[model samples]
Target chain A: MSGRSHDIPEEVQVLAGEYVLGALDEAEMLAVRRRAAADPELAAAIAAWERRLAPLADAVPPVAPPDELWARIAAAVAPVPQEAAERPPLHAPAEPLVPWARPVRPPPRRIWPWQLATAASLALAAGLAAFALLPRPVPPVEMAALTPPDAAAPGFLVTARPDGSVVLTAAAPAPVPAGRDMELWVLPKGASAPASLGVLPASGMRMVLPTPPAPGTQIMVSLEPKGGSPTGKPTGPVLYAGTFGALSP
Target chain B: MADARTADEPTALLRQVAAGDRVAFRRLYDLQAPRLYAVALRITRQGPLAADAVHDAFLQVWRNAGRFDAARGPAEAWLLGLVRYRALDIARRGGREVSADDLDLPEPADDGPDALEVLAGSRDAAALHACLRQLEAERRRLVLLAFVDGLSHSEVAERVGMPLGTVKSWIRRSLQSLRLCLEGAA
Candidate 1:
C-alpha cells in the first residue's frame, strides 16, 4: 500500500483548533477555510473542535439588539416589496440636518458596542420614522384574485403591470411541505402549455416575469420541489388559478 | 440526545427555510439571533458591526440553508459558526482600530471550574466540561480568553505576557489534549 494514512495531519488538526477557537489571523483563517473545503478530515476536525468549544458561548451575556435590527435583517432576507422600495426615500438631505452628525459613525478603533448600539439605534429610528412619512407607490395597473380549487374566498391577490412586474400577496398561504416549493405559471391565450414564472415566496410576495405575460393571460400556481421544477415546468398539483383583469385604485 | 435535539429543531426549521418558508426562517431567527448578536457584539465590539455581521449571517442562512448537513455537525454550531466568522472578518478588517488595551478583559471567575460546570447543559457541553477540566488551569484560562474573548493568538500572547511562539504552542497542545480527552483517553 502507498504511504497514505487516515489521520488528519497534526498541523491540520491544530489549525482546525485555532480556526474554531477564533485565534487564527485573517490570512490563516481564510487558508483554513479554503483547505477544509477540499479536505474532509480537516473539515471533520474543525467541526469536532467547534462542538468542543461551543459551550464557551454560555459565558457571554446576551444583549437585546435594537428593535429595528429585526426589520433590517428581515428586509435583507426577504425580497422587499419592489413597489415599496421604489418610492423615493421620503426626504432628500436638501439641507444637512447636521453636517457634523453622521447617523452611523465609522467605527472607532476603540469601539464600544453598548454605547455605539445606543447611538446608531437612535439615528436609525429617527431616519425610519421620517422615511415612513413618505407617500405610498402608485397602485398597480391590474389585479388578479387567486382562488383555490374548492374554496369560495380568494386565497391571494396579485398586483401586476404590463411591464412584467408583479407583486403576489397571499391572503391565506397553505402549509408548504418541508421539501417542496410553490411555483407560479402563466398561460397566454394560444400557448399550448403554461410557461414557468418562478418559485413563489413562502409568504409575503414573490415577483416574477421578465416580460409581463400577454394581456388576458391566465396565471396559475403549483407546489413543486424547493428549487422549483427541474423541467422548467410545473410538475406538482396546481393549487390556485387567477385571471388578469384591468383594475386601478 | 438532548444535544442533538438542541440542534435538530433548528436544522428542521432551516430545511423549511431552504424551501423558502419565511415563517420557519423567522422562527429560526427568533431561536438564535440573541446569542448571535451578543457573540458578534463581543467580537466586533461595535453595535453597527455586530448588526452587520448578524445581518450578513442570516442572509447566508437563508441563501445557503439548503446545504446544511445535520450529520456533519449540530445546527447550532453551524449557525454560530457563520456569525462568528463574519464578525471575525469585520474585526480583522478593522484591525487598525483594535488596540490591545481596548479589550473587554474576561472576568477572573469566568473560566473557573464552577462557571464551566454551569455550562453542562448538552452532551457536547458535558463532554467539553470534562475535557476542559483536565487541562492545567493556565491553558484552560488561555482557551477561554481566545474563544470567549475572540482573541487572536498574538493578542492572547500579549495579554498573558508570554512569547507569541510560546502561547501558540501551549494553545495547540492544549487543544490536542482536549481532543484526546474527549475521545475517552484518560
Candidate 2:
C-alpha cells in the first residue's frame, strides 16, 4: 500500500485492498475479479491483503448457531448414497471432531505434501477455468436457463449479448398473482448488491444490464408488488435462479 | 510435537476433508462454525441469511477443500473468506422474507473496540493493529466500516458524513499507511 510490495502497481494494490475490503461497486468488483484470475501479481496482492487483515476478524464476537444447523450441514454435505458406500459413514462421528487433546499418533499416510501440492495446483487450474479466467476470446453470445428448484424444465431462457443486454424468455406465461409482478435481478460475482434489471413481462422481454454478468454470476427472478422492488433490491421470494454460464439445452 | 500438531489442526483437517474424510470435516465444522456464523451474522444483519451463508460456505469447503493452498494463506483465513464472500452476496441481494425467529434476535452491538483496539488484542494481529493505530482515527474507522461491517464506499461516506470521493481517498491512504507501517515493523 504505502511502498509497493513486489513492485505491484499502486493502482493494483489499492484495487486489491478495495476488493478485499468489499468496497468496490458491482462493475468495479467484477473487473477486479476478472483481472485477478490471470494476473498472478494482482492475485498475490489480494492474498497478502487477506492475510494481513484476516486477524482483525477476531474482534467479531462468536455467536452460537442453531442446534439444527450442524445436522443441516451434515446432511447437505453427505455423499450421495452410491458415493457413500465407497467412503466412510458421514453421520456417525465416533472420533471427536477435534482430536487436539488426544495423544500424538503417527500421521495418516494416505495424503502426502507432494500429493496435496498436485491437488492444489490442479484445483487452482480448474478454479481459473470455472471462473472463465482463460485468455481465450469471449463468446459473442451466451445463454442460461433459469429453472425452479423442483421443476426439471427451465422456466426462463436468458440470452446475454456482448453489449451487456439480456433477453429473458419465459417458457410459459410466468405464474404471477393478480397484483404482483415478477422482477429480474442479476447478482454479479463479488458485487455487494443484486442490481435489478427491471420487471419481466409475462411472455418475454429484453433489457440492458449495466454490464454483462460474468460466468458465475447468479440470475434470479423474484415476485414483487405491481411494480418492481420498491427498494432497488429484491423484496419477495426468489422464484427462480441459475448461474449465468450454466446453460441447459 | 503436540504443540506443532495442534497449530496445524485446521490444516490437517482440511487435507483430510480433501480426501473425503467426513469425520475430519465434521470436526473442522465444530471448530470453526461459531466464529464463521458470527462473521456471517455481522455482514448479513439477519440470522437466517447468516445461517444460509455458513451452510453454503461449509458445503464449498467440503467440495473444494482440495483447492486450499497452504502457501497462499492460513487455513482459517481461507475458510473465513468463503463465508465472508457468501454473506456479502446474500446481503447484496437485498430483500428476502425475514424469518419470524429473527424478529426476536438481539441487534449487533455498535459500541465495541474500534479497529485498532480489536486488532491490538490478538498476538498475530497486534503488529497489524499497531500499524492501523498509526492512521488518523477517522481514516482508521473508515477502514473498519468497510472491512468489518461490510459497508460499501458510499455507505461508509454516508455514515461518516463525508463526500464519497474524500472517503475513498482517505481509505486508500489509510490502507497504504497500514501496509507501509506493517512492512517496516516486519
CAPRI category for model 1 = acceptable
Give all TM-scores, in the order shown.
0.59, 0.61
Which lDDT tens digits does candidate 2 get at residues A90-165? 1232222210111112222212112222322343223332333223333445687788777667888777644334
User: In DockQ, how does model 1 score against the reference complex?
Assistant: 0.25
Q: Which stretch of 10 consecutive residues in model 1 chain A shows the poorest summed lDDT?
A: A96-105
DockQ of each: 0.25, 0.29
Q: Per-residue lDDT of B1-186 in model 1, one digit per residue for the tens?
A: 986676578988988989988778778888898989888877876565676678779889989999988876778888989998888887776532434344453433435565575676545477778788888998998888788767789978887899999889999999888877776632
Candidate 2 chain A worst ten-residue window by lDDT:
A98-107
Q: Estimate, for each residue in B1-186, the C-alpha lDDT of model 2 and write its tens digit.
A: 986776699999999999988778878988899999988877776555677788779889989999999988899999988998777766655521223223344654443355456667678888887787788777878888887777789878887789999999999998888777777887
Q: lDDT score, residue A5, model 1?
A: 17
